[model samples]
Target: MEISKGQSPHTQPNMRTAKVYTALESLLCVNCKQQQIIQNCESFLKLDAQLRNKRARELKVCLNCLRGGHFLSNCNSRSTYKKCHRKHHTLIHLEVNKANETIPIPQQIVNENTITNTSNQTNSTTNLSSSTLNAQTLLSTAMVKVNDTEHNSHQIRVLLDSAFQSNFVSEGLFVPQISSALPTHTFNRNAIEIPPNIKLADPRFNESRPIDVLLGAGIFWSLLSVGQVKVNQLILQRSKLGWLISGELVNQRFISDQTRASFFSLNELDHKLERFWQVDEFTSNDHILTNDEEYCEEYFRKTTTRDEAGKFIVKIPFKASVHNKLGNSYDVALARLKNLERRFETNPVLQENYIKFMQEYQRLNHMSNIENNNDNAFYLPHHAIIRESSETTKLRVVFDGSCKLETGLSINEAQFTGPTLQNDIFSIIARFRLHQYVFTADVEKMYRMVWVHPEHRRYQRILWRETTNDEICTYELNTVTYGTTSAPYLAIRCLIQIALDNQDYYPLESQVIKEDVEYSQEYSSLPSLDMSQ
Candidate 1:
């Protein structure tokens, strides 16, 4: 049976008359949704093939997201994705996109405990994820097998050592003691006081003491205070005992031990005694008055002393006293003139003209002295004298000469040794000369003024004591005496003690004045009168 174009198969005329047409129309019903007529069948078949292809391209259930069937949204597994949002949840599957290429099935999730157990039997077969690994899993997998029954403590220690190698614990961090419950003990908050009488062991004093110890300790303390020795580290140990040193014990050490045990001990005592006696601290004015009184007393005591013959005795011999007095006068005159010259040199206005005048005056004076001595055969007498004291009948002498006469002579060669002696004699003579004062004094017996050391007393011997039958023996120097070659040197040294003690009589410019007289002819013109003449 042939159907017309665009005609419904359901309404087509009969194939074997009307009966065949009815059977074909029943087979392809128009209202039935599942069945299709022969003409519409090609369209329905094309649509079914397209739907099947789209479903094939869609994702299977995610296994992570259990709800959705296609991809994560269509996933049906609920147990696999349980508690996925929790903090400790292990992430197993990871999809990585590289350069716009989709990598399929990148990772698989496995329980850590299961992996640890399975790793014992077959080391290679267990496909375990790394993200779910705990410290136990790492220890079991990398260090030891779970099936191993015995393990060495050293291996565990090595593992622990390596694990903590990168983590640093601060030195100051405190760890609380939480092993047992115990009441905490609180320290006393109040300050404590200490008494003054307490004594402590001074490390300085412990080292050494009367003479040797004292000197040693003095040296040690001096060095320690100045940082030459690290006393803190030497004496202190890193313990509770060191902490005790921070309190009153240490304070007392510095106060009592340091002060009373060191160099300050004698000085402190003297100061205390002076305060107690005077009711006030001693001042410069007090020292000056006391010194003056002492000088007068000493002078009177010496003047009152007499010899066996009942005559007043002088300390300095007459000859030496006169010479020193005259020498001092000349020294003063010369110094005054020299000082004026120095002032002139330093003066801006007078320097040029004054210097020329000074030179000419000096030249003339020098020429006059030479001409008088050479042409007239006039020699200036050495004005010094030696005399015998009436009472003691002992020889005495005086010094009278220009300090200038001693030019080019050293103190060692002339009259003295030691800085103290040189400074003292020069100071004494200089002050008297500068003030234009003449000293009228006598040496009792110049030689006798010095007491020889007992060990050296035998060096002084007299003929009467050695050979004469006379019961009374006189003392005479067998070694160099005060008037001999070495006399000046010894006298100068002896004079230093006097000079330092009696500084008021020995001014500062004594040596300078003597220097000018000895070396500079310019000083010779200054007005000078020697009473020793």
Candidate 2:
């Protein structure tokens, strides 16, 4: 028999082959139990290459068999029989198409019992169709429920759950309740008041007590309250005997109305205060001697004698202590004087009457004193003479030990040269005067008492040596020595302290200066004299 146009050889029931084909011809759709003719079957193929081989081996099965539509024992025979019948029916349907005659399957039965049964089956199919419907029925049901009034009550609950999960609530939302439970009070702002007496205590009050008294009270309070300035200890123990009120109180505030009036009235006090810390007029000069003619003539006549050569040599007591400490013979001091004359030849000031007196004194007594060994007649150079005695020793040691004179001349000579120099010298002299009266102090072993720092000690070393065990030992400074950068500064520091300690009794009269050293007392005033004496 010839096969139809759309049929493949695999579709023929008698043509069985072991090779499977995925084409439409090889398929037998078990759903309708029909041969998969080329016109009736759909192609079964994998879209991806990876699944192609697996899909080729996959056996196509019917969905009805998977759902247990037929008895398992009779499935094979039934499937075969259905396939044959379908093919025959399709062929008949096609042949009838040539005659254009329409034929329908028996969808209705004529028997009454059969009609009832068909109705039941129809109802059953309707139910089955309802079960298989898409999401439209579920959506309609949900819409009806949402329209109910009872469902609106859940909206707030849903919103709260969403907010909680999102964590949008503030942390302090509940804190006020706890704090409110603990305390309950209202502040009466109008009831609080400041007192009139306390208002007077304010520092800004214009009509308050005199500034000096106020400052004095403040200082007293400060001393008492802070326990730093012990007035009782100061009085009893005498620890602060010479201590003066200085700093702000001494400078800006008045100790009394009288003090204030006095301070403001006079130019002298104003100048002194302004220049209080300035060096004295006397000590500012490098020289202690003056240019007064009569003074110089008298001093020269008293201190000098002429030699055969008419050379004037100074005559003044040259103490053994001065000679010993200076480590120089009398001849050296004499030579130095000659050199000084040569060096100062052009300085008219040095040739003033006072200096001339000194020159005459030297010339008159020089030869006689040297020959006769008259200790009182022979005068030593200022640099050569060392002050002795306990009082002078201590003062000299403290001041001269640290202070270096200028290289060219004695402190006295330098002082007479200029006003500024005079001021500095006077300042130092004032300090010394203050020290004498206030402290009632004496010099220690002077030069021997001065102690130089080890680092600076080398600067004071002398070339001379002493023989010890027949071996020479170089001489080094046994005490603080002059002629170093730090010396004058150290001396001024000591002098200031001494002046402070003695301020109460013999307050500084003038400032002092050595070379460049200067000292001034900011709080200095005229001390009351003991007129009864």
Candidate 3:
């Protein structure tokens, strides 16, 4: 790439740089790119510096790659012209663009699921890498305005998935039966520049809103036709749904020569979880979830919703089918309540503490009054675990999730106990050494933060009375019952979700919360406390 003149614009053009740049413009594979280097070699060649630089700048292509729409400072391209390595392309000298100033190419992040699912072995890279996962996974998303049952239009964020086979709607959205905000309720959304006079399908294409509807391949191509406007890597095309943007976005913010991403395989976590939580029997070495755990997740996706107050609402994952609905266990619950009363009569202090606990629950609106009907009812008998040594909670009430009826079926037996979704304590503890600054915080009423579905609340009923003088009252736990098998999974899931949704603003803290935090507490080991802000 050595030229006779570095600053002379009248000098000869580098044929090798031209050929290589042409091969790159053609979108050649790595092998072809290598062949491009082999077939056409670079000798002493030079092009007009001022003429070329002006032309390159006008075309908005980086001088290094001569393809990507960027300045020489942000070029991610490299030259292989017989190992004649210079930051800039051979045709354009260093002084032509920015004198000796090299801008590193920004990196793209691969889908976490892609990396996790492909690799299963423990010895770092044990899992199969289907492809180079260094690139970001881009989804074609748009803010779609759809009319509800009342014919009022509301914007719901949608994902245009051309590879998917079907469409889906999130039950969390307050849409009419037909379908599917906050500090971000109204923010300055990012706007992608579209072609003039082209009516955009969705004006707010860059808002970070929740995905409501997922339109698959069947509905994708049908919406888009021949109309397309290119904006760098992004392609804005007209569609039946609206104008949608596809492809990656370049952000100079993350440009760095090095990207240190710790790819902790989910399989590794599963194995570590097994070792951490000792079991009598060995788990399958395949690093896949059990049938019961898989079923629990599938059920959650199909039935989960969000109420007005922003709490995650979930159904009790009942194993019973349509034909095998179990009868009410009211009589059994009544007998247990009577026995509990007898114990309270002897220990008035215990009863007083328990009553206060239940009162606090009612005050927080964590339980609701439900009609005492025998149909499809399963009352959970409860008792208090009094730890006098404990200062904060001397009397903690716990529901008897395993209380069985005459039919020999208990709530625990009839429902799925979802797999542990939280990172093992061992791993979180191990991460403490990675950073210099660390802090921990306990989440208040963690299990009470998540809500259970109203329809399925009947299955979580309990019997209670202020005193023996008062009549027995039936109440269903509105929040996730603490003793229920699925409670941990549900509550931990919410914590993880909070971290994920806010990662854009609080990346380091969110990472700690999502991957490092325990069930109800956060032990965030950050590089510095400043990052938590």
TM-scores of the models, in the given order?
A: 0.17, 0.17, 0.46
Per-residue lDDT of candidate 1, residues 423-496 (tens digit) = 23333344446644343333333333444332322222221111123242223232224333334433443333
Give the alpha carbon lDDT tens digit for every residue of 1-533 in model 2.
23333446557755544544454443544334357422232332212222322232243322123212333343443332253343122111221222244322222221212211243322211111101111110000000011111111111000011112222211222221211110012222132232222211112211111111111222222222211222221211111111111111111121112111111124456577657655422322334444442343344346444347532233222222332232222343344344444434554443353244333333543111112232312122322222445342221211122222223222222111111221344544465455323322223322222344333233233221111123322233433334332333333434443444556665432121122133222322223444212
Q: What ranking emerges by lDDT with the best candidate at the front?
A: 3, 1, 2
Instruction: State the displacement of the C-alpha of residue 371, model 1, in Å, after optimal TM-score superposition.
Output: 58
Compared with the true structure, what per-residue lDDT tens digits does model 3 show for residues 427-448? 6776776789877888888999
Superposed model 2: Cα runs more than 4 Å off: 1-450, 466-470, 483-489, 498-533
Each candidate: how many clashes? 28, 62, 11
lDDT of 2 at 201: 17
The TM-score obtained by model 3 is 0.46
Hey, what RMSD does candidate 2 come out at? 47.2
Candidates 1 and 3 compared: the better one by lDDT is 3
